[model samples]
Target: MSNLKGLAHLRMSLDDIKSATNDFADNRILGRGGFGVVYAGQLPTTHRSACEPGTPVAVKRLNVNSHQGDKEFLKEILMLDSCKHKNLVYLIGFVSEDTERILVYKKEDNGSLDKHLGSTDLTWEQRLRICLGAARGLEYLHSSVGTEHRVLHCDLKSSNVLLDANFEAKISDFGLSKIGPKNMPHTFLATVPCGTLGYVDPEYAISGVLTKESDVYSFGVVLFEVLCGRLATVVKSKDEYEFLSRLVKKYYAEGKLDDIIFPGLVEQMKPGSRELFSNIAFRCLNQDRKLRPTMRTVVKELESALEHQLINLDDDEEIIGLSGSIGVYNGHELVTSLCFTTNKRKYGPFNPEADNRFSGSWDAGLFDGFYGRHGSYIDAVGCCLKAAARPKAQS
Candidate 1:
């Protein structure tokens, strides 16, 4: 524990930790896992620590009887203390006195990404941003964290990706992480493979040979989880579990990815953005480890995907009305023409037609956008409206 001694500034007494967590009250607990329970608390700033005084924090108290012992605890402390990035969880301090093993981290207001999966609240753009942030964090760990060695996050899952108030991702949990030689194309370590079931790399698990690509494989599962809006593993029955990685590969190969895409997300996703994002995600899951892209490439692709999504957001324009033509074609009613009316001028009458026309005009309220179904042609149409802004009183 000599290395721990050098982190004295980050060491908090057991008494302080207990005080912050109200003596491990049930209500203070934020979450629980194989390691232990995490508590929400506000530690006094009196101690010389990384966080502000009285800042809200999450204090993870390790289970004494759990598999994670002093060794794992020490590894977590050392890993977090050395690696610092905006997209990585910030370690505030720790308590390693007597039988207790606790680590404190800056609290993330939005919690883990897993909690929001399959929910409509998270927009397509927000999910892309979250993925990009996590990728950057992983890239930092894999490339630049250490002078002689790069870190490999053996466990990369949605639960480990925490989200701040702004929905920025912060990769957490480093007890199972390993370090490898820097600048090596593939540094192999013969060790027992360990990671979350579905997220674990099959090659490493079967051969007990670990490499940087193992982390990439796990990250690939995470990318698909975000895109599909589900966990990597799902309970199929009492004795069986389904892995999302396999399903994604099958779906991608068959070009049936639309069947598994999160319900509302497809509507928000641009075709090009979805294509780019899914292509990268599919490439990540390739069976050949050599084919998996480096974390740097993953970051660039995510950036491009985000840029593609942002191309026609029309953030500057305030839409006020919509006019379009609907006609019956081949026994199906379809929208044939559409135009957006903004504060400045009309945008378009795409696929214009004069017959079977419908128009909606609003002056005070804002036009959110149009929503409808589409096949070979637009099948139906509806618009989203927002209440007008309340006028301010004169001073």
Candidate 2:
């Protein structure tokens, strides 16, 4: 690799990356970025001081068809080589060999947020935290740079967010990152259509205007997914109000915000928290880019919402008369669970250990919300062996 300018990529051979990835084996592949393939290859721990007893770094390879990835490789080495924002994917460096390129970051065991959200795996509360962390990462990127220079993650969604050992989110995929050009309008500009389908900004997707709002729009879709405990989008439109913007419009205009909320969440969640999410989701999907919340605002709102909804006051359960309920801890992820019965009526989880008091902590939503609403008067609030306390009825 020859250095053309004072600042150029200190290149490593792509053959090394290929060897780490086992010739791009399917299992080594972490995920598909917008245009490139992100591989979860590992390298020796060069930053030993920050490392634990033993840890290796992660590597991501660009796909051969990725025309745009070639440009992204240079930008990553030149721009993100030294910058260390916890939210942004850390770049240790890159490897380049003739036609192939590889970008490396710290390896994460939990993989992408996509694993948790897409599979029948993650609990609602876990998904909520994932959303908040991803939002904050984007928030930091948009503001961490100097005020004059702001970065926009052209593609923001669950898949691009990788989770480290402690489950903290780190945003990846710089191939679509669009930093505001100096001596140019930062407001909005026409560009080629980019980004994922469900998460894409409708206004931008239609007009080709890639603004900061486009990222916000994608975040809003992600927020909806977080609340619903599902992916934010689908290719074939599901319904008239399925588009996040329309849902927001209908909720504010018609005052039927509750209608769109995932019924499972509504039943388990506190009424106030439910309304708060609806309001924030409304703020994010503003049809006009000028009206949408910035990444900073979106992050704060989401983090605040997660705190509000997931907060556990064991005392509150007693007040609601749900001090004891029979439940499996983190029961929301169980797909084909059986309905436990009491008094000959099969409803909710059975309360065999009714004497035990429910300990409310971070992951109490399945008891409070999801599995809590199976029966008319049943609840999700419960200890591992006891029946959920029902203040009134769950339906």
Largest lDDT belongs to which candidate?
Answer: 1
TM-scores, one per candidate = 0.79, 0.67
Task: Report the C-alpha displacement of residue 87, candidate 2, in angstroms.
Answer: 1.6
lDDT of 1 by residue, 1-395 (tens): 56588988788988888888789899999999989999999977566665667888999999999888888898888899889898999998889888888999999999999998888899998999899889989999998898789998999999999999989999999989888888678877888889999999999999999988899899889988988999999999998999999999888889899999999899999887899899888888777889999998887788667756654435456677778788877998878777778776775554336588899975635455554433234545565544354345689
Model 2: which ten-residue window has the lowest total lDDT? 368-377
* Candidate number of the best TM-score: 1
- Which segments of model 1 are wrong by more than 4 Å? 313-395
Compared with the true structure, model 1 gives a TM-score of: 0.79
- Across 1-395, the per-residue lDDT of candidate 2 in tens digits comes to 34324433444456656665677789876667545777766553332223342345576667767666566667666556545676667665576667667777777778777666544455545665567678777776676666567677788887778888767778887677777743443456678888876788888889897887888888887777666555665435555324544555666698775676555556666555566566777778877778888776765565455545543334233222223334345544222222332222223222223333353324333232222222112333333322454455568
Candidate 2 matches the true fold with a TM-score of 0.67
lDDT of 2 at 298: 67
Off by over 4 Å in 2: 1-10, 32-36, 44-57, 118-121, 181-186, 235-264, 310-395
